[model samples]
Target: MRPILLSGHERALTQVKFSKEGDLIFSVSKDHTVCAWYSANGERFGTYKGHVGALWTVDVDPHTRLLATGGADNTMRLWEVQTGKLLKTWDYLTSIKRVEFSEDGKQLLGVTEKRTGQLSHIVVYDIDSNPEAEQPDEPTLRIIVDELPRVTVAGFSFLSQYIVSGHEDGSVSQWDAKTGELITNVFSHDADMQVTDLQWSADRTYFLTASKDKQAKLHDARSMEVLKTYVADTPLNSAAITPDPQSYVILGGGQAAMDVTTTSARQGKFEARFYHKVFEEEIGRVRGHFGPLNYVAVDPTGKCYCSGGEDGYVRVHHFDPPYFDFKFEVEREAASQSRM
Candidate 1:
């Protein structure tokens, strides 16, 4: 597969996501702005601007008509996707690290870092609430887990009844979204290894996590048991699963914060690795970025995926027909051998 490079951000990209309808791509960057583009051809649509500080994350609602963004300005804001008009803003005491919409689009979740640095909180807002009505002083649910290390990534479950979070100390926790009650906590990696990203499978039966510990793991979403582990030579920053039935995992990462001063330095440490989900075999790597890749997202159809990096570039990679042909052949061979 060849990557179509999309360049515009003046600083590192923090998040990249394809719209639910698969027509547009949206990305947020340390440049303090969010931009939209045509998913098929990489044409720039327009930029969404308002934040006074660097943007950290973004998510689109299930309908793909609204967007949510979190930033160092200590607020999460909602915007209309068509005209880029700011819809609402929820202020916080510190920088917002992540923002996500529930599967139903009726709720929004956000994680923020407090001024004390060690303390973090998760807030869930009722998106279906009347916008014309008086805005509440606080979120519908505020969850403060003092026992957890600082959170790195978080999202709602497929049913939107539970909130799952990954922490700086390599732990994973689940909580009741409505009651703000802790459900379970599991040690996922070695001490001090941060869980950098999390992605759920298309069916929501399993979830994948990437970590600073040089590994990406697949876990059963219900049992919370480790199902498989994919090891890498360098620390992994982001991971995602294709929506295809024969799902393959895509991951990206590198040595932390290497200075890219020369041609060779630019070529090193930024590769998107592919792995077969069932067989756990490495397939291929896509190399292009000059710095560490920070985010990746697979399109809903599973024919392509996109990556954002610390080098301030977004790349969209579409698979060649032969790639899928070869993958299916391997799957068939494995299935036949198992039946014998």
Candidate 2:
């Protein structure tokens, strides 16, 4: 399938997200800029100008009117999506590594990096969707992660009942969303591999985590059980779960840029690999990015998928007819049997 390339960032991209309606894409990069692009033709729509340091993560509200970003500026900022207006900024001691809106967009969550004298923290704030409304200056709840390794990625879970976090030591912890209490913890990935990304399913009932261990694992939100694992040859940086009509997982990673000059580089690891969700077998791949892919985001509408890479470009790809028709032998047989 042909892909639409959006070159909006000057440095390596860290995260990419699609608006709920699937009409717009938001991307953040190490260039310290945030860009908005049209999904249809990859047109540059607008840029949110702030953040002195490199941006690490970005997310849009469900209504598409609000935007949130976290960065090395040691701050998490909110913006008015339509006008590109800066709404509020929350300062922290260290870099803000991740930011996400809750399922209903009623709350926002951010993860801070642990450095020097500062400890990593998972903070939640009640969000007011209206652009003109003054956002709160203080977090509603803050969970100081002193008991575990630094948090690398985190987000809200099903019904906003739980908060899930991935750690630098390759562990996943579940917390009470309202009271900031630790519920349970699981060492889902290999020790010290460092979880790189965490993304939730559409319903938020379960989620996926990608790690530098060269693998991605699926976990039940409520039970904290390891549901499945998808393995790759290269250390993974990102992973995504497609929406309903499609049952697939998208994985992206490769040899880091620092390792490229070592003469041991391979090409296959740079490609985005797709695997069957139920069968746990790789089904296909999309290749183009020359550098390691840092993140992959599937359109909530399931109409397209995109990848942001160390190459400083976001490739948006809409699906082809074969993508919808693909099925395993068992799936085909079961469909034919139903017709009988």
Candidate 3:
């Protein structure tokens, strides 16, 4: 499939996200800007340019009406998605590393980096979903990460029953969304390898995590159990699960750019790898980026998938008919036997 290349960011991309309907793609970069694009043609919709420092994360509300972003500017800001108006800003002690809207969009969460003597924190606020409604200044909940390692990524789980977070020390923590109480913590990934990304399934009953340990794992959100594991040769930066009709997981990462100059692209492993979710086997891989891929996000409708690379481009790829038709030998045999 021919990929639509979006060269909207000047610097390396930090994260990429698709709207609920998969009609739009939102991307944030270390260039201190966020860009919105039409998923169909990769046409630039607009840019949000208020952050003074590098942006690390971006997420849109379910309705695609509000945008939440966090950055090194030491602030988490909200913007009206349609008009690109700055709606609210919540100042913090350090760079905000990740931002996300809950399942309902009535609440928002941001994870602050532990830096300059400041402790990492997971802060949540009551979101006014309506673009015109004034957002509150104070957070409804604040979680300080004093005992464990610093937080690297976090998000709300199914029904907003739990708030899940990945830590810098390769551990994952589950918290009560309403009471801000810690439920359990599990060191699933290799120790000392930071958990780089956390992404949920379509139903949010389970989630996937990528780590610097050269591995990605699927975990049960409620029980905190490691359900499955996908191993890779290089450290992983991001992992995403495809929605219905496709049982595959996307893994994106490679060796650092500085360390890969002497090696070719093939040896560098700068490609997005697709693995069979149920079988835990690699199905295929897509190569394009010269530098390491920082993040990968799948279209909610399972029509296409996109990857943000350190090469400063977002590649949107639509699946071909062959992609939908290909099946494992076991699957083919099952289908044939069931027909009798």
For all candidates, what are the clash counts? 0, 0, 0
Candidate 2: tens digits of C-alpha lDDT, residues 1-340: 8999998788999999999989999999999999999999999889999899999999999999999999999999999999999999999999999999999998999999999889999999999999999899999999999989999999999889999999999999999999999999899999999999999999999999999999999999999999999998899999999998789999999987787556333553788999998888999989888789999999999989999999899999999999989999999998899999
Model 1 worst lDDT window (10 residues): 128-137
lDDT of 3: 0.95
Instruction: Look at candidate 3 and tell me the lDDT of residue 88.
Output: 97
- Where model 3 places Cα greater than 4 Å from the true spot, the runs are 336-340
Residues 139-161 of candidate 1: C-alpha lDDT, one tens digit per residue: 89988868888888888877887
- Runs in model 1 with CA error above 4 Å? 129-137, 258-263, 328-330, 333-340
Per-residue lDDT for 1-340 in model 3, tens only? 9999999899999999999999999999999999999999999999997999999999999999999999999999999999999999999989999999999998899999998799999999999989999899999999998888999999999888999999989999999999989999999999999999999999999999999999999999999999999999999999999998889999999997678788887788999999999999999999999889999999999999999998899999999998899899999999899999
Per-model C-alpha lDDT, please? 0.85, 0.94, 0.95
Q: Candidate 3 at 19: error in angstroms?
A: 0.5
| C-alpha lDDT of candidate 2 relative to the true structure | 0.94
Cα deviation at 8, candidate 1, in Å, is 1.4
